[model samples]
Target: MTSAVDVVVVGGGQAGLAAGHHLRRQGLDFVILDADAAPGGSWQHMWDSLHLFSPAEHSSLPGRLMPAQPGEAYPDAGHVVDYLADYEKRYNLSVQHGTRVDAVRRNAGQLMVEADTGTWRARAVISATGTWSRPFLPATPGREVFTGRQLHTVNYRSPADFAGQRVIVVGGGNSGAQIAADLTLDGHVNVTWVTQRPPRFLPDDIDGRALFDVATARRRALEEGRSDTGGVASLGDIVAVPPVRSARDAGLLSVRPMFTRLTADGVRWDDGSHSGADAVVWCTGFRPALAHLAPLNLRGPRGHIPTDGTRVLGEPHLHLLGYGDWTGPASATLIGVGRPAREAAHQIARQLST
Candidate 1:
C-alpha cells in the first residue's frame, strides 16, 4: 500500500528542515523521510572542534537568527545539530526517522517511495540530501596491504578519538585544517597532513563575492552550475588563515603540500615523506549520494543529480536547495537557504495548484 502525501521530503537535515518550514508556511501537506534516528545529519559526525568558517551572522538558516554574543565566534558542528533539533521542535515539522528510502519510482502519476518502513506516495520529492551524502575516498593500489588505521572525516569527531595516536590528516580543505589543528592541541600525537595545494587560508570571517566565486567554481565543476554566495567562490577564495599565522607564531600545527600516493603502510608525497603516523584522516570531502536514485537517470558523470539553476533539469517535481546557489548571495549557508526554500516552495505550490 502507498501512503499518500502532498510532498515527500528526503533527508531531514538543514535543507530538508528548511524545505519543510517553507512548505508549512504555504500550508502544503508533506512528510520528511530520514534514515538517521534524529534530525542532525553530517553534523552528527563532525569533529568537536569543527565550526562554521562563514561566521554566526552568515551561518543562520531562515526564520531564525543564530544566537551569539556580539561579534562572537561561529557555531561548531554540535551547535548546528542542536540548532536543527530546536528548529524542528519550534516549527512542528513532520518527520519519519529511522526510515531508509531505498527507491523512488512513479506509479500512475504518483511518486512511490519504497523504503524499509513501507511505501510512500507523494506528489513531489525534495532531496535535501546535500552533496556531502557520499564521502569520496580515492582508491589506492595497496589499500589492503596498508596496516595503518584509515578513516574518513565523516566518522572522525573530536581529538579525543585520536588522542595518543599518530595521525596523518589528508586533504587541505577547511575541514582538514580544523582536524589537524585540533589533533595538535595537546601535543599528544605527531600530526602530518598531505594535500594538493596549501589552502588559500582566508580569515575565518571574510565575506563578499569572493566567497560566491569560489563556491560557483566548485559547483560548476561538480554539478555544472555557478554558485552565488560569499566565501569559497574561487581558487582565489583560499587565503592565509589568521589562525595559521597565529598558530605558526604561537607554535602549534604546521601545514604542508598534497599527499601524492599510498604505500603499503602510509601515504607518500612528491615533496617528501612525513612518516610516523598510526592513522590517516581523509578529509578529502564528500560526493552526492543518489545511487538509489539512478533509475531516474538524472545524475552526471560524477554521480550527482545534475541541475540547471539548482532545479533538477529534466525532472520538474525534483529540486535541490544547495545545488550551487541559484539565488543571490548566502543561499548555501544555514540562513542563506531560506531564500531558495521560499522560491522552491512557491514553485512546488504552483505545480500543485495547476
Candidate 2:
C-alpha cells in the first residue's frame, strides 16, 4: 500500500515522539514510523541500572508530565522505558511498529522512505535517530582474537550480567566510566578501563544541558565573528564538578591506559603492558548513519550532518535532532534533544504550512 503522510518520523525515541506530539497538536496529517517493536529506542536497551542524571522535572515530555513515583533519584533505564511506553499511550501517538527503515530516498518534491515492511512517502522528514544507532569500534591490531565477551555499551544490560567475570571497558566517554563503575562496585566484577584520554565526570548536582547552554552562547559569539560567550564560559572553561575524582571517591575502581592492540588471552597497551580479561565493553562514541541516504547531500567531512545551529544545513525539509549543535551540547541525552526537537518541529511546521 502506498501511503502518503505529512511527515515520516524515522525514529521512535524521545525526539521523534516529541516531534509527533507537536505535529499532532498542530493538527497536521502525520504518521510516525518507528523501526523498533516499541518506543523508548536506546532507553529500552540501556543497562538496567541506568538513570537520568537530570531530575524528574527535567525529563518531561512535550504535553505530558513524568510520574513522580520514580521521583528525584533519576529514573532508571527500565523506568525510562516504562515512561516512554506510557508516553506513547498517553499521547495516543500513531506508530507503525517493527517497520525497519531500510533506506530513505528523495525525489523532486517529496521524501521517500523504504522500509522492510512497506514504503512511506512524506512531505517532510525528521531524522531523530540519534548517533547511538550503531556502536563505533576503532580498529586495533589483533582485536579479532580477544577470547572474551566483547560487547559494545549499546547492548550492555548490567554489570550483574557479567558478575564474577573480568571485564575491560574501552573508550573514555561518560558511558564507559559509568558502566565500568557499575561493573566494579555494583556487580563485584573486575574491571579494566581503557581510554586515550582520561574522563572528567560531572557531579550529580550539575547537568550537561546547563553547561552546553553556556558553551552555546560562546559558540554563537564566535560564529558571528565575536569573541567569548558574552561572559558565558565553555564546558571546560566553566564550572566543573570533577567526575573522575567523584567516581574514585565514590568507590574503588581500576582504570588503565588505552589498549594499543588486542590479544587472545588479553589486550596489549602502548607502554609494553598486557592484561587479561573476560569481557570487553566498547564505550566509544558513534557516527551518523548517512551512508544509506546516499542522495541526501548532507554532512560534513567529520562524518556529521551539517546544520545551521539547530536546522540541517541546505536541507530545508530535513532536520537532524540530537546532533551536536551550538544550541545544545553534543551529549545526545534525553535532556539535550528536547529543545532541538521542539525548535526543529516549529521550523518544519512553519515552512510546511506556508
> Considering only N, C-alpha and C atoms within 3 Å, which residue pairs clash in candidate 2?
201-243
Candidate 2 lDDT by residue in tens digits, 1-354 = 678888888788887787788778767777777778987877887777566655566667667776754444556677778788888888888877787777777866788888788888888887777667777888878879888877887888877688788788887666777777667666478788777765544444465446545645665677689866543222332122233334467665456677778899888878888877888888887776455455676756865566774566766777666655433443255655666677777787898888
Evaluated at residue 348, the lDDT of candidate 1 is 89
Off by over 4 Å in 1: 54-57, 69-72, 204-231, 235-245, 251-253, 271-274, 300-304, 324-332
Q: Which lDDT tens digits does candidate 1 get at residues 1-354?
A: 678889988888887888899999989999998888987866777666566655565666678766663444656677778888888888999988898888887677777888889898888888776656688887755556668888888888767777788788877776676677767765776788667765666654454334644554554555444443333544343333444445545666566775566666666666775455578888887765666566677866755556655467767777766543543234555755676778788888999999
What are the per-model numbers of colliding residue pairs?
A: 24, 1
What are the candidates' C-alpha RMSDs? 4.1, 3.3
Error of 1 at 318 (Å): 1.3
